[model samples]
Target chain A: MRDLELNMVFDPSEVLRPSSFQDAVETLDSSDSKIVAGNTSLYSLARKGRLENIKKLVDISKLGISYIKEAESQTSEEKKILVGAGTTFQEITSSSLINGRPEYAGLKEALNKSPPQIRNVATIGGSICSAVSFYDLPIVLFALGTTLKFFSKKEGEHLITIDSFFQNPALYGKSLLIECQFSSSPNSASSFVKLCRRMSGYAVAMTAARIKLDRTSREIDDIRLVIGAMTKTPQRLNQVEEELRHKEPSIETITRMCEKSADLVHDIIPSVHASTAYKKRVLPILLREAITTAVERATER
Target chain B: MLNETRIKVRFILNGESRNIECMAADTLFDTLRDSLGTMSVKQGCDFGGCGVCSVLLDGRPVYSCLMPTWKVEGSKIETLEGLKGKELMNLDAIQQAFATNFAQQCGYCTPAMILNAKALLERNPNPSVDQIKDALSGVLCRCTGYMPIVEAVMQAAMMRRKKTQV
Candidate 1:
């Protein structure tokens, strides 16, 4: 029999319902708390005794937050897609907005690169909240310049830029996440690339790039690039984007920018993966391929 | 010090209402097989790495092995047995296709596979091979590979189309 003394499973509060986050929080407040969503990754942790620290679980399955909403941007005339924290990667990839949106190539591509089982059960909220480097969605969200709306028990509701969101994920201690919103840009093309050992596993390296090129001028109007599985968290390469903002989307300029990215990655990320040496050697190659693919996609439409 | 005790949770399982008093630590998988005697939902891997313990909660497919039974109160639960006699199964399209296509060798993985496929076809009546692969990718089948399983789904789709025409 399992030892109940060392690893105690606390009794849950019966009043909590599936439809309320507040209720879920109340349950967590009563004892040592852990939140359950999808549980694909969490269960493994529990079974392995990694979560021996946790005694109470806050179930978030019925929080009524699993949704994909397209709302008009208040400042910009563009429309933004808001994905609830409970929205699974599978739901996002298969959603009509992602598959049908010509400009959302990066989002669709990132979803494709993620593993099958993880895609099915891994939620956008849980993945982002974990802040793991290998997660596929963060790079895309950061590249799209997304915003996260966090709900904290102490501070109530607060909004943070996707870049700043990763800077510190510990802000929301007891409260939960609501959703992430990213306004769709006009005349944009996106691409996502992953260097993984197989079809379904954590990424060794990954990149999500969104590029908008002026057809008449052939100059890059706007660009965003985010890299994951390289550091403490997914990073948005703002310096590289600044370098390529007005330049023509040519081979020489692209290669230079990619090289700069490799240097930045090398300096920022320590203890890279087992494939780190090989990844550093081939960073530019993958970056160039991703950029080229994004450019091609943008030009097609 | 915090006091731990059992919590009472009630939900509908396979069209019957059940009230299960369990510890918050007890997962839906454990409650079903041990407490409720619904052994159809096997525990291939309790860690959720294997999708063998998949069940339908409120009509969506989820791995029961990881979900807490206490969290499922007031929610509707359906297992492989629920699908066995449903009108959709009686059409016997997919199950019949599986039988005809030699989709099972060991047969241990069939229930999970069927449930996964059922969930997919419900969402998308006719999914491409790529989409089918995506849908069932969470499930692991150590026997017959996936080609025969894929062919069975395709044949089932064709049969559904045939029935629609008549």
Candidate 2:
């Protein structure tokens, strides 16, 4: 379809740039109206004649929601960072709150490692909303236990966990993702790793982990592991998490649990681009690397 | 079912504010090449796969081919068309560096390569080797291997710093 950009094309009937977030949400009244933040992926689909039926284009880039807000957390005394969906990858990578903090190093690395051009224009909201398997942010957020907030004309606003949102992503009806909030815990250490042809290449398999260890006993208090790209959606290693917690934090223990993660993964989506065996083979390697990094970074006191 | 609509988008092109009518589906690559005649933004892959269609959107390097024309409304767009000196006979440091370093063989990707280099140098006047590679990773240079391109960006950076000192 790259060849057809100039030859064959049909335009949407109207392009609306709403002045406010509510106005942008109200534009969803037309089921055919599609919201465009960066238009990196949507325009590609439209050029390929895939979304020929979309009549109206909703522009939400002008909304002031493209920001990163840091405030005290309700769940804990620690501060939480609220990343607006409209925040660009460039902004995320440059923000002191997100990139400057050592705990968010994995997220910063993931955002910075993407194709420099794509990173400049792609927005966090657009990435989560599209929820394509190839995206790097979703897997990182999965391990972070991020909260997604949505707004709609009918529903007003509702908050849901990213895990639940991933479960039934299609349930997003006519809602717009408002922001993604995740806590910053000094005791926890998080790491992200991607396995593919290149840094920006589509993931053959990837994994992320956030681990917290008890200072006195040096035993694991909490662990969240997630694998992506190999599955239809990023799969959380709940079984592996249960196995690793309360165990003494050690390379031997972490390695065993990471190897066990291969069994916890499900529905490894086979594709012509990447064979199932190839993805499965790389899955354990990614898991071990991410988990090891998380373990090394975890504070004992 | 089918529909058609054209929106008038106003943006600063190269340095001048301009307005153009385009279909909502029209990409920045198409509008720059077809309507406004800013052909420097080449269409190498048309899709986002190739960086030959790269442009600086508000001083950030992005693939114009994948971006809708309407997305640039009320924004600054820098293309190779504006990468020049005071006179047509003169060229900017990046342009001269590429020429001196022999960075262009096919010349198809030169415009975007230079534009991307310009954007990178603006933010990072002195970049490390890995930083240079990461910045140019998107813009594919099939000919005249990356050594020359990398050298050109470094030379441009060195020249800029010298000028600042003087």
Winning candidate number (lDDT): 2
Error of 1 at A7 (Å): 5.8
Which regions of candidate 2 are displaced past 4 Å?
A: A1-10, A72-77, B1-4, B86-89
Candidate 2 lDDT by residue in tens digits, A1-301: 1224343554577788888768988888777888988776886676567776677888887777799878643455367989888888988888888765656767886787677789988888888888766688888888888999899787777899989988988888588898989886766778889877767767777788888777677788888888878878777889988988899878888778777666666678876667887777777788888878877777632
Candidate 1 lDDT by residue in tens digits, B80-148: 777654465464677888888999898877777887787778777788999888767767889789999
Q: Model 2 Cα displacement at B65 (Å)?
A: 0.7
Can you write out model 1's per-residue Cα lDDT over A158-266, one digit (the tens) per residue?
Answer: 7888788788766555667778888766667788888876555577777888888775787889998888777778877788889989898888889988987777665
Index of the highest-DockQ prediction: 2
Summarize candidate 2's per-residue lDDT along B1-166 as a digit string, tens digits: 3334567899999999998887767778878887789878887776677799999999988998888887888999999888768364688998889989999999999998888888889989999878888889888888789999999999999998898899
Name the best candidate (by TM-score).
2
Give all TM-scores, in the order shown.
0.85, 0.94
TM-score (C-alpha, index-matched) for candidate 1: 0.85
What TM-score does chain A reach in every model?
0.87, 0.92
